[model samples]
Target chain A: MDPYALKKLNQCRRERRAALLVTDLGDGRDRVVVEGDPVSGLLGEAVEKAFRSDKSATVEVDGRTFFLNVHLPPPRLVMIGAVHISQALAPMARMAGFDVHIIDPRTAFASPERFSGVRLDAEWPEEALARSPLDAYCALAALTHDPKIDDPALMAALEAGCFYVGALGSRKTHAKRVERLTAAGVPSSAIERVHAPIGLAIGAASPPEIAVAVLAEIIEALRSRGLEARKGEAA
Target chain B: MPEEVQSEPLDPLMTAEDWMKAGKDVAIATVVETWGSAPRPVGSHLVIDGEGHFEGSVSGGCVEGAVVAEATDVLSDGKPRMLEFGVADETAWEVGLSCGGRIKVYVERLG
Candidate 1:
């Protein structure tokens, strides 16, 4: 691999972007393909697959074998509340291979003892997000139920194109949320994506069960990522 | 992908660039392919300097010595090499992967 390619690949990784280091196994020539970088032909299709699946593999294209080394930013779960649900979510998401961060301005709830090894932020969502920022690879769950805490976060997640954005609320609560979001000019289409009454309808009544539902929903959003785009193309 | 804090010190590719920038002749060995129970996954990297000093792993400590030795040769010749290691041939290599898995490691000099 070329040194330049290595540097570029590493840069993408550090910045939490997807990149592929495609090396021609026959000639040792290599290049870095960042996400959304146009690649054509059979190799382009293979690279697209690699980006979606986050798998590295050797592909035979035009009688030449190329090793496509996929480097994807690890998926992250950011919770808007440090309540019982988030306490359950923090550890559960970690076990589910997500980097979990819980943000709550309530210092009592954000205590380290409750969070243990999880990243706990005793700050409001806008302030915390301004420092760290959200990206496409992140999943944001507004578990606070209070719009004061959850609305800014929901808007930010929608704006950032978070793979999953779910808010904890009943249908009645979500109706009001929709009105508020529309009043705030968060386009009706963007507001539509928030999975209100968050999580899979698994009849989850307990905090841990709710965590499982939310996690499953997040995983579904992650795995079924491109299917919606394909649907758009079909339309 | 569990977000293990990717501390730069733990990454072999970052180390390769640091080593190269420090004027040390370096070679990088990457696991190109692996079959059945291979300890390291494909795209795992090991960077070796000319002195046989190495960082990272191509196997579960079972095949590093051989890969490091070959990395020295690649560094000297400025050529790339593909090495296959497995329990398939104990006599063929100086050492074999005792884990009963096969792996192909691609070794090349880092520019």
Candidate 2:
């Protein structure tokens, strides 16, 4: 093991940052250990912190000091539509560490089989979003491709102060969306925050590819939000 | 990966300079800013010592040479300096930093 990995591990242990031990299998594969076998390698509270994903924790190992972010970033994905993109996106977002949730009045589209392992709400947009609640850390995306569904969700997300709000469509479609949202009592500034034509310009065409692009944009937004928060704290 | 055992704990929010000023000799390199998809966050700090020891990270193993070089200079001069690395820098992509993220590190010596 390189000293760097050891040093990182020590710091993470001290700070209670969740760390996985990477074991090379010599076959383009690696094994991960959360707390070692019998968890004996973890000294004191480091083991406990790893399990809990604590924020701001400290651990001592091998005469080194480790500081860790015990708090795991729990990002929420609020999807307004239960379309193909949503289906493709839900699983991928979960893999990327998002708590996926879907809202749509159409129960047929928002079903257990369609959105398995996701929080599905078969209710009107306003009702569903109010029940689930929203926070500054949440990422709200409208993909219904229908103004009726997407607009209401956008209103709910904006009112709840979501960190990232995006809608899928062309530039022309987005302009119309902006107009409708503005007329619906949503402030233009608040509506401006929505990332229309949502996602990086990867020129994606397929649903899966679009999901990839959109999720990438979401992560970037999340990172930027974190930087801003840090700056605010410093200020 | 082999885990290291810790002896002394330090504050995560404090940079290496802050730690050194408190009486512990420390060398720190910090990522002041970043652009694009950087693996590590800006304001990320890496602290080193006279024994060739260190903590934290600036890049995902990329641009480490430059950071080490700057850290060494800080240790010798007993002063602080800033460093930049990214896809924009000709030498950075060679070090495997291809994410197009730009990082500025402030290396400071504290004692």
Candidate 3:
């Protein structure tokens, strides 16, 4: 690998982007290919497959072997509420290997002691998300039950195409949210994507159980997102 | 954050850059292919400095010594080579991987 390639790869890792290192075994020449960079031909198809599968492979392209090294950023869980469910969800999501972040403007709920070892931001979603910004690889769950806090984050998550967008509420409360989001001009298609009532319907009555349900749903969202995600991005 | 994402403090590629900046001739060994339960996945890195200091693993500490020795040659010659390891070593031609797996590691001098 070139020194510049290594630096670029590390930069991709830090900035939460995907990158592919393509090495031409025949000539010993290498270059870094970042997400969405176009390469036409059989090599481009192979590159797309490598990125989708998140796998590295040695391919015999054009009778000369090439090594494709795929680097995918870790999927992150950005919960837009520091409520009891988030307290439980934070650590559970971390244990399940999702980069977890919690945002709540309510400083009392976003206390360090309450959510130790978690990235807790006592700022509104608009301010905090501006710094970290959600992406397609993120799962956003709004659980504050307060529209003042959760609405902006939900709108941002919907626009960002977060893989999982869940909101905690009853059918009635969610209906009101839908109306508000529609009035705010969020696309009806995107607004419909939010998983109202959050979590899997596993009869999760308690906070921790709800956390488990939400994490399971997040995992499902990530794993089941196949070619459709790329198509969505391309569209 | 990369530490948590990497799950390890040392990333071989980053270390290779650091070693190069400190004026060391560096060789990088990458697992380009693996079959049947290879300990490390393909694309895993084991970067070796000219003095034989290494900061990653292409296998479960199985063939690294051999790779480092070969990397020493690669560092001196500035040539890249692919090394294949199987289950056992018979002729000093192939090393053992104890886990009954096979892997192809590509070693190259990085500039």
Candidate 4:
């Protein structure tokens, strides 16, 4: 590897940016393409495909084989509640390769002993979100039934274009929430983005089962949106 | 940026880079493609140093021995090699890939 490529790779790693390292097997020459860079050829198409799939691949372009090594930033999960469900969700999310963070204003619930080996932010949702803005690669879950905490976090997630925004509540609760959000000047379209009655209909009645359903739904949302966006770009 | 998030350890690439800095010859084997029933997904990596120590997995222990052997060659010669093993290829049983899947791994010496 050239010094310049290594430097760029280290920089991308430091900045948590997604990149693809292209190695031309014919000549052993390497090139690095960071996310959002203009890629304008067959190699560009390959890189774009790899980026969309989030998988490295061996692609043959014009009879020359090139290996696209994808380096993606870790997916992030921000849970707006340090409740029992979060206890199950945090470890599962971490195992699924997400950088998980649990936030709550309640010091007792978000205590260090409760979430050993997990990141906990014992601050209000709005304040926590202000410090670490959500991005498209993030999945936000408002697990606390309290409107004071969950609503602000949901709004912040929507504003940040989080890939998944789910709120744990009943349909009636969500209806009441819609009214509150609408009265608070939130647009209907934005309010609709929240996946109320959170998690898949897996008949999950326990915390661990509910955690599985929620993570499954989050993965579904992330992959479907990514695939759709890539299809639109390819079209 | 909170201190906790910043204090999180970097990923495996950084570990490989540190190994190189520490004067250990390192080679990385990446799963570039896979067929049916592959244990590890595409983009999975196994980083091996000159002493046969490895981090990460390419086949969930079904093929690490062979990959490490090939990586040793790559480290010695600095030559990049693309290797393919599968049940359909008859070498799969010998390599312990008997779970019926094909995988193409690209092994390269890293600086």
| Greater-TM-score candidate between 1 and 3 | 3
- What is the interface root-mean-square deviation of candidate 3? 4.5
DockQ, all models? 0.40, 0.02, 0.48, 0.39
Q: Rank candidates by DockQ, best first.
A: 3, 1, 4, 2
RMSD of each: 3.3, 16.4, 2.9, 3.5
The lDDT of each candidate is 0.89, 0.68, 0.89, 0.85
Off by over 4 Å in 4: A3-7, A10-14, A95-97, A179-187, A202-213, A230-235, B1-11, B87-96
Docking class of 3: acceptable
Can you tell me the CAPRI class of model 1? acceptable
- True-contact fraction for model 1? 0.50
Which candidate leads the pack in TM-score? 3
| Residue A146 lDDT (model 4) | 96
Worst window of 10 by summed lDDT in candidate 1 chain A? A225-234
lDDT of 4 by residue, A1-235 (tens): 4435756886796676888888887877787899989988898888987888787888999899988888876779999999999999999998887899899999999987888888899999878877777887889999989999988888888888888999999999999999999998889999988998999999999999999999999989877976778677789
Instruction: Please provide, for model 3 over A1-235, each residue's C-alpha lDDT reduced to its tens digit, 9 standing for 90 to 100.
Output: 6788878888898788989999998778898999899988999999998998888999998799999999988899999888999988888888888888888989999887898777878899999999889998899999999999999999999899898999999999999999999999998999989998898999999999999999998998888786665778899
Model 4 CA lDDT for position B26: 83
* TM, chain A, every candidate: 0.96, 0.68, 0.95, 0.89
lDDT by residue for model 4 over B38-108, one digit each (tens)?
Answer: 99988778888999988888897888999999999998889888888887776755785777888988888
Reference-based lDDT, residue A60, model 2: 57
Q: Write the per-residue lDDT of candidate 1 for residues A1-235, one digit (tens) a residue.
A: 6889888888898899999999998989999999999999999999998887777898999999999999988899999999999888887888778888888998888788888877778898999899789999999999988889999999999999999999998999999999999999999999989998999999999999999999999999998887876677689
Evaluation by DockQ, superior candidate among 2 and 3: 3
Mind giving the per-residue lDDT tens digits that candidate 3 earns over B1-111?
Answer: 211222445888888988989999999999999888899999999999989999999999889999999999999988899998886546235568888888899999997
